[model samples]
Target chain A: MIIAMASGKGGTGKTTLSVNLAKAFSQPVQLLDCDVEEPNDHLFLGGELLNETIVSVLVPEVDASRCDGCRACSAFCRYNAIIVPGKTALVFPELCHSCGGCIKVCPQNALKEVEQRIGLIRTWRSGGISLLQGQLDVGVASAPPLIRVLKERIEPDRIVILDAPPGTSCPVVTTLRGADLALLVTEPTPFGLHDLTIAVEMVREINLPMAVIVNRMGIGDDRVQRFCQAENIPVIAEIMDDRRIAENYSRGLAAIDHVPGFRAVMIELRDKITALCRKEA
Target chain B: MKIAFSTSGSNLDAPLDSRFGRCASFLIYDLETDQFEIISNLQNLTAAQGAGIQAAETVVRSGAQALITGHCGPKAFKVLSAAGVTVYNAAEGTVHAALNAYKAGQLPPTSSADVEGHWS
Candidate 1:
């Protein structure tokens, strides 16, 4: 079963919950960091780099010699990546969405598609858990493509835990689309509640069974709990506000390592998640 | 020489839209013919990304030598400047007023983008 841990607000402990939960399982598990823009799960896991793959997107390249000043490719390109002025077609790879419409519509056959490196996918193993992460190149606007590429590599036999990027945008949507359950990690602050509401709506739209985990439980009021109760969403667990957990996190250590009793908390959380998945099955 | 102004309405009396990429319409005026035409910018307004670059390409395709808009982004400015199109700042007023200002050379030509990308 695939479980996606997501949070609408950044710094809400999606990675923390995902990493610790993956480590809690005695059986081999798969941990996928779908936050391609900045994959930090490797920092907490501290595993050896097993394999790496570079991902590329096809962008249009124009040959001005064979082209007339017809502007056909420019007119056909929805992204406006191609600009045809007089006798040349200027291609902006950054703006290209890799749709290849410009090359198909070129009347003179002057356009050709070229591969442009967009991101990387790396796999690592530390103990029974195998970690896969997608790392998008800097200045690349799109992450959904890389996330899709990474999700395709998920092993079906093992239990998969996905660490989704923050927000209800395209990347998050792509990460949680096919998951068996969504584990929304949130805080008790107003910003947390506001964004959690958005995240819940997104999960509902995607038609996934989900529950909530309120991180930093003591930092704010009980409004998040009240809201969750009113919405009939289950609060699976709450990680109390502890300075030791924060210190361990800052030092790239999981709560299970430095904070006492945290291991049991994560183990119980993992069992609850397993039960939820079984209920769905 | 021909000039283009980002306008909210079809006629010369429309207000000058501050947004370049998401402008409702564009007014293209020819100095030799003394005639103007309004083209609706529906596609770029609804574009999720690259709207500025798309709008710039449309203006360049219209054969306009000068553009009068409230702001221009770096990417759009590069596209326009590469096509030898001079950019001018559109003052706060109707499209007709902006046209008159351009006629009187009151609008200054910009060497760089006045606003960052995706300003709207």
Candidate 2:
């Protein structure tokens, strides 16, 4: 079962809930951190790295040795990534979307594909969980390519848990698009409610089965619970804002480790998710 | 004679307005008869992601002779350039006004100093 954990706004406890629940699972699992931009699940899990590989995207590179000044390659290019002068061509790598049409239509074999490193995908193994984390190189604006790399690394059949990026944006949707079930981890606050609404709208648009896990539940009002109940979005679990728990968390301890009793709650959460997936079928 | 207009959206029903990156449509105008007619935007492969690259690609793929948009990232400008699409910088306003300005050749097709980030 591929379970995805997502939150609309950042820092709404998506990682916190994901790490704890993943740790609680007794069965072998693989945790995927799809938040390529800012991955923090590793900080919580402290897993040992197994392997890491740089992921790059192919961009067209124009060779200057060609004879003719004809601009067929440039003419065929729809993305303006190449500018062919009389005897040569200039290529802006970032603009090239790797659509080989430029090469296919080029009169001269001046255009060649070159790789540009965009990000890295690392695999880690912990107690019982195998972690897949994608880290985008700083200054790289794109995340889709990296996301593809991470998702492609999914194991054959395992209880995969994906820690998705925040917001209802492109990266979030791309990561959660194929999720069996998305766990919307949230806090009970006005900001949380507002963003949760957006998240809900996005998930509903995609028609995914989802439930909410409220962290720091007692700190806020019942508005969150009320909204979830009204929308028929089940509030799967509630985590109180316990000072001891927070302190333990700061030391890189999982909530389940500090409070072993919460494992049962996660078990129930897992059961509820499995039931939802079964219903989906 | 075809010209693609840079848009924030990928279609006619595409909402076009914003800080260019988030703009709705990249109105592709055909320069047939020395006038402009818009062609379709590039397919929105990223209905899941924002209309950033898809809109830019629409402007690039429409294969229009010229592109009209409010603003553009250097990355997009490069893509459009490679696609043989001449980009014109226009201000955000009614679509008709922008189109007319393009017909009169009043829009600036050259990138401003601010537009050129690393290269002067």
Candidate 3:
């Protein structure tokens, strides 16, 4: 089963639950950290890197001498990011979509496409799990490109768990979409509850079935549980605020490795996911 | 030359208009006949989550010089670059709009992928 572990906010143990769940599954599993901006799954698993690939973007460089005063390029652009004066055309590097429609329009053959490196993809294998991660170059701001690279390395045979980035925006949606089941990881504080609602709504809007896993369960009030019960969304697994687990987490260890019950809970979680997938199928 | 518009569904049925805020779906157009042929998406393999790379490889394999799409991230942009396909950004409107824009020579020739997670 393909499961996406996502939360609305950061620092909600989304990665912790996702990696642990992958290890707990009785069968072979693959864990992918789709949070390209700050992937921590590898930090937790600490496996050897198998392969590295550079992901690139398409950009246009106009040959001024060949460029005619034709406005075909501008007319094709939906972003309104380019400016072509009577004699010359200028492109805003940031807004270009790399569609190559402009090149087709140029009668003079003035535009030559070029590539710019965006990020790196690393594939690694843990004991029973193969990890794929996208690490955006230090200065790059976009996760979409890196996320694309990581997704390319997915293997379907094993149970795949995606550690999705927080929020319900395009990146998170891109990472979480098409999963067999989505496990929404949230905490118990008021802040966690508020963001959880947003994430839940986003998933429902996508028409994907999802459940909730409240990490650090006991510290916050019972409001999260109340909300879940009211919505009829099952609380799959609850992890309390344990000092030992927290310490292990800070040192990049999966909670199941340090906690006694997390491994068993993950096994149960795996069963729940499989049952859900069968029902949907 | 035969042109293939990179598309997300094999049969042009799975990807509909408006649900994903997309226009006539992602496609490749034949400049010779001015006809649009939607390239089938290989991302359905279950292993590949996003087919940007696969799509680019497919486009490269097709030998299409110029391509069009609404939005593409940086990684796919690189694959297309290796294949020598020029790219344009922000063309999500109707296919007619894209063609007209191309005819008018208003669209920029190409763009690099960098749509999400800007970090200074």
Candidate 4:
């Protein structure tokens, strides 16, 4: 079963929950950090770097020499990545979605697919858990392509946990696609409730089963709990507000190993997720 | 010579739009004919991305020899420059005033993009 840990607001403890849950699983698990912009799961799970693979996306390369100024490529591109104002086509690599529609629409065969480096995927092994994370190159406007590539590496047999990026944007959507369950992590504040409402809507739009995890439970009011109750979504787990957990997190230590009684919480959370997945299946 | 002025409305009396990419419309004024036409930029105005590039393409395709806008981004500036369209920074006034400034050679030709991409 694939479980994606997502939060609408940043710094809401998605990474913390994901790392601890992965470590708590008795069987081998695959943790994929789909937060390509700033993947920090590897910091908590200190393991040997097995290998790194360069991730690239196919973008259009226009051969200006053989091109007529037909503007067919530009007309077909929804992204407006290519344009033919005069006698030659100008291609904007950053704006290209790599749909290859421009190349297909080119009457003169002036466009061809070319690989553009977006980021790198690194694999690490820590005990029974295998962690894979994507690191996007700076100045890259898009992150969904790299997240899609990372999700493709999911091993079918082992339990997979996807550490999604914050927000309900394209990157988060890409990470949550095809997951068995979505673990919406949030705190108990108004900001958390507001974004969580939007996040719930996004998840519902995709027709995915979701559960809420309330982190730092003591800091904010019970509005998040009330909202979730009204929305009929289950509050599967709540990690209490503890300074020791924060200190351990800052020192790059997994809560399952460093924080006392955290292991039991993770184990219970893992069991609940497994039961929910079974019920869903 | 034909020049395109990014405007908030479809006439010379309309205020000049500071944003070239997401402008409401372009008022194309012909120097020789003393005629002008309006081209709506509604499509590019709501574009998810690359609005400047598409807007530049629109200006080039309109056969305009020059563009007058308050601020031009890097991508749009590059496109206009490559198409040999002289870009002039528009003063804070109506399109008619900007056109008069251009005819009087009071508007300075911009050597490069006045603002970064996605300025508006």
Clashes of each: 0, 30, 36, 0
- Overall lDDT per candidate, in order of appearance: 0.90, 0.73, 0.71, 0.93
- Please, what are the lDDT tens digits per residue for candidate 4 over residues B11-112? 889999999999988998999999999998999877999899999999998999999999999888888988899999987899999988888989889899
List the lowest-lDDT window of 10 residues for candidate 3 chain B: B16-25
Worst 10 residues of 4 chain A by lDDT: A77-86
Candidate 2 achieves a global lDDT of: 0.73
lDDT per residue for candidate 1 within B30-67, as digits (tens), equals 98998999888988878877788888878988999999
Candidate that would win on DockQ: 4
How do the residues B19-95 of candidate 3 rate in per-residue lDDT, one tens digit apiece?
A: 11122234666678765566444332332122344455556556677665656555456656655677655344555
Top lDDT: which candidate number? 4
Look at candidate 1 and give me any clashing residue pairs.
Answer: none
Per-residue error at A176 for model 1, in Å? Answer: 0.9
Ranking by TM-score: 4, 1, 2, 3
Q: What is the RMSD, in Å, between candidate 2 and the native fold over all Cα? A: 7.8
In the range A1-281, model 2's lDDT, one tens digit per residue, is 88889989788878877787788778988898999999878888888999999999988776778626476776666665665422466666666667788777877787778899989999888899988999999988778778977998787478889999999988888888888888898889999998999999999988888989888877878888999999999887887777766776788877777775677776777777778777875
- Please write out the lDDT profile of model 3 over residues A121-209, one tens digit for every residue: 88888888888888887766557766866776667656889999989887898887788788888889999999999999999988788
Candidate 3 overall lDDT versus native: 0.71
Per residue, candidate 1 scores C-alpha lDDT tens digits across A1-281 of: 99999998999999988898898999999999999998999999989999999999899887778888688887787777888754688888988888888888888899898899999999999999899989999999899889999999898778999999999999999999989999999999999999999999999999999999999988989999999999999999999988898898899998887789999999999889999999997
Question: For every model shown, what is its TM-score relative to the native structure?
Answer: 0.89, 0.69, 0.67, 0.97
